[model samples]
Target: MKRIFALFILLSAVFLTACGEDEGNAGSSGEKDTINFGATAGPYSDMVTQAIAPLLEEKGYEVTNKEFTDYVQPNKALANGDLDANLFQHKIYLDSFAEENNLELSEVIIVPTAPMGIYSNKYEDIDSVEKGSTMGVPNDPTNLARALIVLEDEGLVKINEDVDPLRASLADIEDNPKSLDFVEVEAGQLPRLVDSEDLAAVPGNYALAAKMDLLDALALEDMPDDYRNRVVVNTEDIDAPYVKDIKEVIESDEFEEIIDEEFQGFGKPKWMEEE
Candidate 1:
């Protein structure tokens, strides 16, 4: 009878240990000592490797970066607790993605982001863009709108004033003063169009991946603050210690100094600029 009682106690202890682990790991990958960070395979990933990870290491945190070639996987990874945090998407995209996926995620902080730009192999400047020239724009709705807004800013096109600029599309163009012909292509494939199209509107990330200089573009989009890429985590882990640590590392002067030195053409987020 004493042996039977002892076995019961041992089983109960093991069950309790398993329950505690489940509760602790409910919202993230079961490790607190190491962070699983995800980003698209480009400048943003470089930001994590070059700037953020060193400071996180100083705090005794190990950062493991996962480079995804496309946009869909990062958030999916975060939602499934395969990643603790990620840094390649803007707040707008994060909100939209979370809503669509029914995932609870939140932005911890925004980071300096590369802006979309108008690149040309033939033209030296916006003024040199010939009328009726072919322009390559992102086929994806979000970035297509961004490209249109940049065109409107450069007086190349006029979008309908009634539409929200964020939702603007080729159909929303009320006027084509330059008679510019827009070719819609995948955003990543845009940099390749630079040599073929008269002008190509390339998102900053893709341009950097293609080794094109941001400053070399004829014009860069003046993006809204929310459009800047942000560090994101599961909303359940929004108040986690590691999230707080990530924010602290980003807000430090060391992060900005690294940005100025390495990420020169990237635009600063409003929070950083306000300081």
Candidate 2:
């Protein structure tokens, strides 16, 4: 009788322990309480994962970093609920992308703008650039307009006042004093053209990827007060706790320090403040 009682007690204890273990495992089975962030594979994404992710993790939120190569998929993932948010793209690009794709994504925060620059292997300086030299610019509509605007600002070319910044093309150029040859190439291919073309207006990311010194570029666009840098999320998730946490972490002093230290004047955050 004593042996039977002892065996029954042991069996009861073992069953209780098993039940507890199962409950704990079940509680942790589904998606973690994580903020899924999407970014392109570049300094921008690296900096965020290194400087920003750890901070959020310290606050008890898991961080998942998703890398994208193209411009469209990140926003699409956010809109489709595959991602919690995205860190790439500026407001201009985001708005245009949404309009084109029929997405209803919204900007949750403005992070930083990578000042666009024009790089060349042939000319030592912008003044040394001769008239009629071939110039390679991004073929994308928005960037094409931006490149033309920069040229216009430098008195290198003149564009019609009626030309839309998002749709401007070579046909919109009203004047080209040097008979400059404007070559339209895909954005990714523009960096490769630097070896052949007299000048190329390259995005900052591409310039960095090509290992070119950003400071060596002959000209950089003034991106201050430009609505071209932002992080976006679906409208439904804008008010989520994790999304709010991400916004705070991005706007924190830590993130700013990382940007200043890593980018060395190339990237800077521009967060909106409450009045």
Candidate 3:
């Protein structure tokens, strides 16, 4: 009986020791309070780690960022739980992605990315461009409409006032003062066409991807607040405390300082612009 009792004690001690080691290992991994974040490869990812993550740490949250090279994967990773949240795209892209994929993602907050600039390598400025000059624009819906908005704002073209800005197409153009010939190209291709087209409207993300300077562009649109980039999360997490905390941090002055210091015209905040 004594020997049996001793053996039972030994087994119990071993089991407890094993369990303790597992707990210790988990703590050592340093992911207990960490949030997995996703962003695209340029300034967005840099801002996440350099700016946002530090703020999250101050609020007792740890952030680990995953950077994606292209547009498709960040959304895919977030939808399937590979990422806790993603901060790379605007509302238009997120909404269209959700509808098309039947994935339920929700926007946490609108983050200010840089405006889509109407760039011209051929002409020195909008005024110098002659009538009937070729224009390069994005063919993708959201960016295409975004480009049109800039063009119209610059008085190079006009869109039907009734059309939704997100859905506006060439067919919606009410007038073309320059009789401007628009050549539809992929969003990524517009920057490459700077020397060829009279004006090419390029989103800041694509501009970054193409290694172009946003501040050097000739004309920028009066960017609407809705056109701002968004930080998004799974629909189930829309009301989560951490998500709310994330939004608060984004809106804070600390984050704004970081944005002004790091991102230049790309991913610029409205508050930063005011300053």
Candidate 4:
């Protein structure tokens, strides 16, 4: 009986030690050496692999990149301590997702993000858009607001003065000078509709995924800094040692050189533009 009891205690100690090691690797546990990052598959993931990871590796950290295929999982992973940081969503999205899900995520820095634009096969330029023409926009709330604001910027439509621009919808349009007919389409499908619709408002990420050039748009969005993608971390780890390292690398001159060389056509944040 004494021997069996001693073995059970030994096994419990081993199990607890293993659990602690796993927690340390999760990043929020204050681990400073091995850091994990999450991003959507494509440009943002490429950004981590080609630009950020090398710099962090040079600083003696082991960096791992996890590519998520959907918008939902990255934040879910980040919130549950699966990722040290993530770089796929903008400030507005970060704020909304955190509030809705009761997650404590925060941004470390905004990165150059692809801007949504008005793409049309029927019209060569914004001026050429005829009256009563139909246009495609994202069905999602945030991006729909963004597309409407872009249309307003181009003098195509006007949103109601009292509505929050981030939550604007087709019903919020106070005036449509062109008498434009609007169609709400799933964001991923908007790119394909460019050949069919009079004009389609394609978000920058989807446009790139569809192999459309940012320069091909009739008018690109004059995006506010809130719409730009950012590096996100758990609120608790905002001031972690590894988080500081990641921020310094992004703000480095070497980082700008990489973005300029590899990420042309992405919209710059105000801080980046000011520099």
Candidate 5:
């Protein structure tokens, strides 16, 4: 009987250990818990909280959004394990940011973004800008190309047609009819300085956040499908089931409602427009 009692205790110990492990992992991969995501502290934050979070919770994820004031911290948090994912940037900004920082970050799904444009507080139109006027463009490669393309389209400048628009830069400008002085500026700073500069190329996100008029743009780009806003996750996590769930949530009808209601000035989805 003593031997039988000892065997019972042994079996009970194994059962208890298994139960402990199951409980410990309950809210992790086995089930969904709080997913800590990051975004810039405006439309991105509002959209995630109002749209993405509710959808995620329906699939069993408790969503928590971390809002940052600038572009740098969201990626940094994602890279450092402080965030599970981020949704503030498009593929172009992500590619440049990831490459320069050596983070193997990649996109999961595309979302609508504010269409990019050149806005001037001083000039009523692009035609009014005098020669030698100094215009501010984003210093980053992707946005700089966008600004250059808009200028090129407006007949103020000529870019080497041989260069892909995605990869074009100041160096690709083959002609400058206005002899406009192109100044490289930080993207976040563009909205505030539009009044001071001859003209400034601004991203839709920042402009919307700053309450600038998207309709008042002197020139706006046709947002290529490649530049659409996307949710980014570390490459290692790209194949994770939770990441797939996040992608599903973003593409759901619930999110579509939020897009229609909240993003009136954000321009149309790039997919809706043809090349």
Candidate 6:
């Protein structure tokens, strides 16, 4: 009986030692070392996964990019601590989204802007647009305002000076010499409307998806010094380390190269150098 008890104690000690080592190894590997990111599904998000994430991994951050379809959920997830960062919206859109949803998110970095363009199968140039011609614009407030701004810039229409970009509408059009009929449609459907309407203002991503070339467009949004293209993070995490690393990766040359190549010069890197 003494010998059996001694043998049992020895086996127990060996088993405990092995279990302790295994637990230590798991603790080291299972610790939270990955930066969880979110982005809308598109070339932009794919670029983040392909170019940006690899660069971050070299710097010791494990990047897990979560893809989202709609705009609001990504910000909400970031604000609620479900994500470390998101790279799918500009400052103007982000500000408007936060205001309408009552969320407190902040801009951490400026990404590329998919320049909004006016496309027309009927006309080759903005000047060719006839009076009383129908024009399609996005119905969403954010994109509607953006489309209006593009029109105003092209001298097609004049927006009211007192109206904010967030709230501008057809009513704000103080001058419309062309008397163009404005047809408001869903932003995603704007490109399709080009076939029916005389002209339509479509966002760059949608235009690309619809296989429309930028050169084919009547006009594109100007990339001026005041252009507001950006990525956003939760206000509480604006200064976080992982978020900073994300900004650096996005601003890196690798990301710039991807933008220039994949977008065929349509998407320029505005964050790094002045255009």
lDDT scores in order:
0.91, 0.77, 0.83, 0.92, 0.83, 0.79
- Ranking the candidates on TM-score from highest down gives 1, 4, 3, 2, 6, 5
Clashing pairs in 5: none
For model 2, where is the 10-residue window of minimal lDDT?
23-32
Per-residue alpha-carbon lDDT of candidate 1 for residues 70-155, written as tens digits (9 for 90 to 100): 88999999989899999888878888888998989998988999999999999999998888899999999999999999999999
lDDT digits (tens) for residues 81-111 of candidate 5: 8898998887767988999999999888877
Model 5, global lDDT: 0.83
lDDT of model number 3: 0.83
Off by over 4 Å in 5: 1-29, 69-73, 96-104, 122-134, 177-184, 267-275
Q: What ordering of candidates by lDDT runs from best to worst?
A: 4, 1, 3, 5, 6, 2
With a 3 Å backbone cut-off (N, CA, C), the pairs that clash in candidate 6 are: none
Every candidate's CA RMSD: 4.1, 5.0, 3.6, 4.6, 4.1, 4.5
Off by over 4 Å in 6: 1-32, 96-104, 223-229, 265-271
Q: What are the TM-scores, per candidate, against the unseen true structure?
A: 0.86, 0.79, 0.84, 0.85, 0.76, 0.78
Q: Higher TM-score: candidate 1 or 5? A: 1
Give per-residue CA lDDT, model 4, range 17-95, as digits (tens): 8787677554445467888999999889999999999999998899999999989999999989889899999887789
Q: Over the full model, what C-alpha lDDT does candidate 6 score relative to the true structure?
A: 0.79
What is the lDDT, from 0 to 100, of the residue 120 in candidate 3?
Answer: 83
Q: Which stretches of candidate 3 lie over 4 Å from their true place?
A: 1-32, 267-275
* lDDT score for residue 132 of model 6: 95
